[model samples]
Target: MQIRDLPYTDPGDPDVRSGPRFLIWLGRNQIRGQLKSLSWGLLHQCSIAGLPLVIGFAVQAVVDRSGNRLALSGGLIAVLGVLIAVGDTMLHRTAITNWITAAARVQQLLARKTAELGSALTRQVAAGEVVAVSTGDVEKIGWFVEALSRFAAAAVALVIICVGLVVYLPSLGVLVALAMPVLALGVLPFLPRATRRADFQREKAGKATELASDTVAGLRVLRGIGGEELFLGRYRRASQEVRKAAVRSAQMWSLISAIQVLLPGVLLISLVTYGAALARDGKIDVGQLVTVYSAATLLLFPLRHVEEIAMAYSFSRPSAQRAVRVLSLSRVARPSTVDAAPTGDLYDPATGLMAPEGLFTAVVCGDPDEAGRLADRLGGHAQPAVSQEGAVEEGATDHEVPSVLLGGVPLDELELDAARTAVLVQDKDPVLLSGTLRELLDVPSSGRVTAEDALSAAQCDDVLNALAQASVDSGGDPMDTRITERGRSLSGGQRQRLALARSLVTDPEALVLDEPTSAVDSHTEARVAAGIKALRKNRTTVAFASSPLLLDLADRVALVHRGTVVAVGTHRELLRGEPRYRAVVTRETDDEIPAPAPPGKDEAIHAIDTIEEIEERA
Candidate 1:
């Protein structure tokens, strides 16, 4: 949030929009700031032109009256100097603040847009491109928008100075006017090449960043396979590519700089030579000659900058285009029947998986991949939307299913907050936040359950004791002890149990947990299952687990084969009915358990109880 720490927002001209167009966008949004900046720029430009004129007038006056008018002209010249100094300082401050705030606002807008699109943002664009756009491109865009105001005012002042000279000394004025167009338009020849080089540089930079990110994420696997050097080589190649692209961009920019500097030098010589001739011919007065020379001299300082600005524009335009592209991405999550009236218990009619109200459902996917995919769907992580995302690789061919629903409604149909409330998925990764035990259980919000309550329910009394115990490692009570990044300090089971406990605290309507006790031993896994069962009570709970202990605890188990549910029954039932289900559930022990019972027994008994209850009421 600190402005000083942020990357430079004013990308100095590598911005994509034309200077005028950028001003138009800024004027549309921050009209007040734009106008204020414009006002300051105008004043600053006026000071430059005015100072020269005042000097020209004072010199003429001294020559004309010998010394009689000297005092008045000298005082007027002093006033002009003071105004120029004061105006220049104030305008400089105003221009800087204007750019800083404008860049900040554009960054805010990009962040807001990213949040709206969420995961879909990357799916709509290359992930590397999104990273580059948010960082580099957004800043470039704001830079151009800020620079446009001053550029516009400077341009107008240049024109005004040219016209004034034409009237006072026509010959000198016309030559100076001719130089401005050549400076502005002559650079057109080199801009295309410059833009092409800029695009290449940006593209290479994105690749380098992507390679770096991917390598870091896969360091563990790479180290295991002894492929660290292979990846390092890849990154090295990417870095080299980036270096080459940068050199090309710099070369083109250098060429543009040469033209900006060299051409203006040529123009200055011609103007000075022509002006002196007019002065020697006695056609133009000495005062006019001084004014003409001053304008031409001052003109080059601004005019040469035009070439630098042209190259800056070329450098920044691609970044702006990328940023604009990212901002333009549409959000996913289409409107559905769930929006009309939320269907209570979770339902997936397509896959024939249903957890009716107040049921302890265990899914037994014949394929481990299918089980995990179904878990994500049940958890509302995957759903049909205007946009689609690539599968989050969970290892080995276990891809995400197309549709997962709650009640009759597709989980994706619900808004994000609503979906989180309805179904909570504890991803395989045990996310350990940096906070006290109470805060970790809290999941960051109001209405959070107390740490003591969630811990007791999770059977974390021992965990708190361990945390509270003082040893060579000492920080605070286990309950108060902060978890390290990714909870690297904690054991795998500790991390998993803590994550499961956090989800339990949310107490969502339907909970979908993926191997909540995978890291724990048999005894701990059994305890977690019992604790989870006791805590769920009336709420629907769906778990994707192959552990026999957790499987035995399920009221009913469904077998998911491939991307669809193959069978629905208790854990024992699936073992007997489906070989694949039995094989997955008892991979360690090939022996299978018999079916527990037919689902009809519970249904038939429920019907009888309903009839008897009605009779009792009558």
Candidate 2:
């Protein structure tokens, strides 16, 4: 496909066996573009190489003092100049096309992989590493890909120049040919060291990037805990490490550049001195001496391309390797045997938790972490076995069959799309993508609920007002106002309510919500809980929450202690009969003993309750 047809409808599956292999695969896929670039590069470099020859002919004509010969030489020089301008311009255009297309293809592939893996990708790879791969690493790989053809064209032109010089002036030509190879190959020994230093720099930079990403994501929480300075210091150290590594890498590349310059200068000096001596002794004419000098000087241009090729490879190899590492990752592959989506109660065998169909079931976990894990399992998202270093361990497998089942059939046995349609899980930390408020809520849905209805049910009228006020200067509708990335521009409660509205719009068969109202105050939580119950009426719903405001509205509440359900009953029934369940839901600890209150403490508590009751009645 051409560059204009970018963002391929499908960036074909990449060969991810190794870094070099991945690069080779990329090259093979874009062979047509590479060849086009190579052709243009050849025209450009060949035209440049022909310049010294034309200059020599002009010099010879001047020496002969023939007007006819001088005119012919000048005409030839003009022709070569035109060819040079045309070739160079086209070469640049084609080369840039190749670079952009290659990078775009890789980005498309990464995006596809990310969609397929979902949240599991971050669990298996560092967020920073993925960012590095898609951004900086992608550019490096593209640089190497585009450089390959140009390097080939330069090498070919160098060969042609050496051959032409040998035939035209053998004495100097022999020296030129011999020294050119040394100039080209002189920096080979230092490449390994340079590559290592570059790799080190890239690693440090990636770590720093990951740290920065994490810091920004949690900046609000850090400030709340007064730990922002602590993290800033850590990031400062990481940034310094990156700077030091970069300096080391730069020092090596600088040394190589010096060698390239020094060797070529020496060759030019020797050729000029020797050729001048020959001309003085009348061994060769002045025009022949001029040709040798010009040829030696022009050769340096192509030799610089040789140095560029080395530098590109040194930087891109590691980048390609990192890209391959991310591409090679696979999620827990489950066999798909069932064709149709199953319907019935959702069951998690591992936790012995069941959510009966057509009911609102509230789950209260003694530990919040366990609640998140249980929520994942209930939705067929069993955590894969990943190492501390964020890699899948050898022999790791996400059960042969899913631990979660629907209608007595394992969820993993059904097609992925079917399983997702059957159950939708909104995690504790749901992300809101940047877009208009209307677009944010526009997802695949049963169409039972409209966006307006969902927004009202989620008590998002205040959010709407905020968005409208924020967009008043732009003269845009509230629904059209844009959200910042991850909805960071909104308050935490606003983001949560918006996410809930999106999920409600989907109207899935089974909905699992984890801490959906955690960010809201008690008053808002009460309305949200009632709205969810009213909206999800006669549908299967499971909520992993501890708030009594939410639990009081549940049709049935399950108390999960130590990863297993210990009690299942109505909210009031459990609160009165099960002390363990009450302790969990109320967040009460045994460490505190009841003590006599100060005079009027009870009166103060009664006064606050009276105010709340008055507000509720109003």
Candidate 3:
């Protein structure tokens, strides 16, 4: 495929069985490109190898002083030169095309897998590892694929040179032929050591990369906790380990490179030395000696490719394995193999937490992990790691956490598109892509809610105003304002509000929000809860939170403890009756500082006059 025609019309299904198998699959999918590259590479290498023969003829013609010999030799030289130029140019063109196309294909596959897995990807694979695989690993895979075709052509050329030498100068040919194989095979023993070191280097590098990614993502938190230096030290140690591994790997490969050069040099010396003797004995003429010597020199070119191909494979093997690891991850929770979205109640058999249709339900789980897992199952995303037996603890009163049921049908049974559209789950740490506000809010919508309505309902007026003020353009419109990645430029409260607004815009049948208002103030939290209740009117909305304001707004509040819902009642009833519920939900409020005494009459008059002056100035 041409570079411009990239992203293949049909990238074809990739084989995720194994790393090597996946590489083979990539090759098979691009067989036509590979063949074209191979043919061009063969012609190019063969043309170079044929050069010695042409030069030999030219040398013989000069020696003979025969009629029109110079002209004939000159014509032959021109023709060979043309073939050499054309072959080299086309070979390079095709090789590059193959490399780019292969990389593009791998990148496309990675992107598709990322989209399919969604947030589950980071849970299954390290964020740094995923970043490394999608970026650096892709290039390594493509490098190997491009090199394989050229290696094949080089092998063919090496054989042709060996055969030609033996046919024309039998004595010298035998030595050179045997020596060529030795030159190619001599480095095989060192390869294992090199490959092992490379693997070590890659492992260390991945860890270091992951550490760096985590450090950057949590820089603000680290600073807040005065742990920035601690994380920096950890990253420094990781980087140092990676450096040591890379040096060791380089040392091994350097030895192999030395061997590659040394063996080929020895072979060249042998051919020259032996060919001289044959010429002296008249068994081979001077021209034949020149041809054999020149062919030996040319053979070095292809011999280098042997080392190159070995190195490419060594590096790419691990990279391909990393890519395969990511691609092989399939959602363990299969929907009920059905195509339609089920209706009615959303039930988690394992936790026995049921949110009946058309109600705003709040689940308060002390353990965040348990709460997150329950949210996943409620959204039909429980991974297979939660074993069937783990569905409900053995002998527990709760029913087995089999596939959650939406209405009466298994949630996992519905088609992915239908199921995803039917139920939307907003994670606690939602991402805001780098784009205009309009694009950020433009999600699959039922057209029942507009962006303005969603934003207002989510108590995002201040967020919109903040974004508008941050806009580079003079229009200062939030819809036109650009948000930085993950909304890093925005405050924590602003990002949370914006995420809620985006979720509201989707207008799904049911929405599951995890700690949707944890970052907002008490007043904003209450407003958001009330807004959500009003907007989602008569639709199922489950908010996993322990905030009193949010829980108070829920039509029904469920207390989840030790992985199961222990109690269910109205927010006020739960607070009055359930001590655990009151303690968990009111813990934040209890820590809050008491209100200060009201200002004195003189101070109040001064504050009022100051406010009036400020209003007049505005």
If scored against the real structure, what TM-score would every candidate get? 0.80, 0.89, 0.90
Residue 370 in candidate 1, Cα distance off native in Å: 4.1
Candidate 1 wrong stretches, greater than 4 Å? 1-27, 65-98, 113-128, 223-225, 333-343, 366-373, 384-413, 430-448, 455-475, 478-485, 488-494, 588-618
- Between prediction 1 and prediction 3, which has the larger TM-score? 3
Clashes per candidate, residues 3 or more apart or on different chains: 12, 0, 7
What are the per-residue Cα lDDT tens digits for candidate 2 across 1-618?
677797798789898877888899998998988888788888888888877777877888888887888898789889988988998898888888889999999999898777655666776688989999999999999998898888988898889889998999999999999999999999999999999999999999999999999999999889999999999999999999999999999999999999999999999889999998999999998888888788889889889899998998889999999998778865444457898888888888777788999899999998888898788777766547342235664544544534688888887787767877888999899999998898899899989989988898899999999999999444758898999999988999999999999999998889999999999998999999999999999889999998878888899999898977889998777765577875676565664322445676766544533324423432
How does model 3 score by TM-score?
Answer: 0.90
Q: lDDT per residue, candidate 1, 1-618, as tens digits?
A: 234545544323222233445444654665666667677767767777776676777788877975646677678768767776776676666666666766676676667666555444554566677777667766666666666666766777778878887786777788878777887777789889888988898889988887887787567679889999999999999999999999988898888788877877888788778777877998877887788788777776556546655665775677766665554443433453354325467777558788876888887665666666566667654432232222222222343344566666666666766766777777666568876676787664224445555566666766666667632344656766767666656667777878888888887778888888878877777878988888787778888887778887888887777656778887656655566775676562344443444775765534533322422322
* Candidate 2 vs. true structure, TM-score: 0.89
State which candidate has the highest lDDT: 2
lDDT winner between 2 and 3, please give it. Answer: 2
Q: List the residue pairs that clash in candidate 2.
A: none
